[model samples]
Target: CVNCGKLKADLNDTSFADKVKHARDPKTRMSVVWNYCKTKTICETDAIEETDPDMPDEAAPVKKGHGGCGHVQPQIRKEGLKLFLQYKKT
Candidate 1:
């Protein structure tokens, strides 16, 4: 439900919706959502220096040696956001 909450919050913000409108795929849209979540959680103690700003916060905290799960969660979250938006528009 966290992802749904995040998506709704983003959708209510005109600027955020505008930013994501050009994202044609789940992967690309996930990047936008991920970056937004990261910015909301950023703190001084988070060791952000080693992480790429463009990487999702979920993907950032992990070390380089670990293999990521191919971003399936992000794709799912993106789909949820799209569905919610479609429902809202109608």
Candidate 2:
């Protein structure tokens, strides 16, 4: 990913499900997922558990975050036979 290095979308995530549903082929699907993942800067956060009406005793499984870092993506730059990673501010 461009920012976060982890996959924030899972099967239970609607965002991921939507991408999967519209995929034409496996290769294209992977590309689509990658493109989307690369554009996202923030990672997913854990959601609060909710109890279902049908199963009052058991709360629905809470979604876990991808635990991605909040740092900016660095770019490689070279000048005068020197190489360095340049991090741009948002």
| Number of clashing pairs per prediction, in order | 0, 0
lDDT (10s digit) by residue, model 2, range 17-90 = 78888998999899878776665544654554556679756455545655555555556578989988766677
Compute the lDDT for candidate 1: 0.46
**TM-score per candidate:** 0.35, 0.47
Best candidate (score: lDDT) = 2
TM-score of 2: 0.47
Q: Give all candidates' CA lDDT scores.
A: 0.46, 0.65
Pairs of residues clashing in candidate 1: none
Model number with the top TM-score: 2
Give candidate 1's error at residue 6 in angstroms: 5.2
In angstroms, how far off is 16's CA in candidate 1?
Answer: 0.7
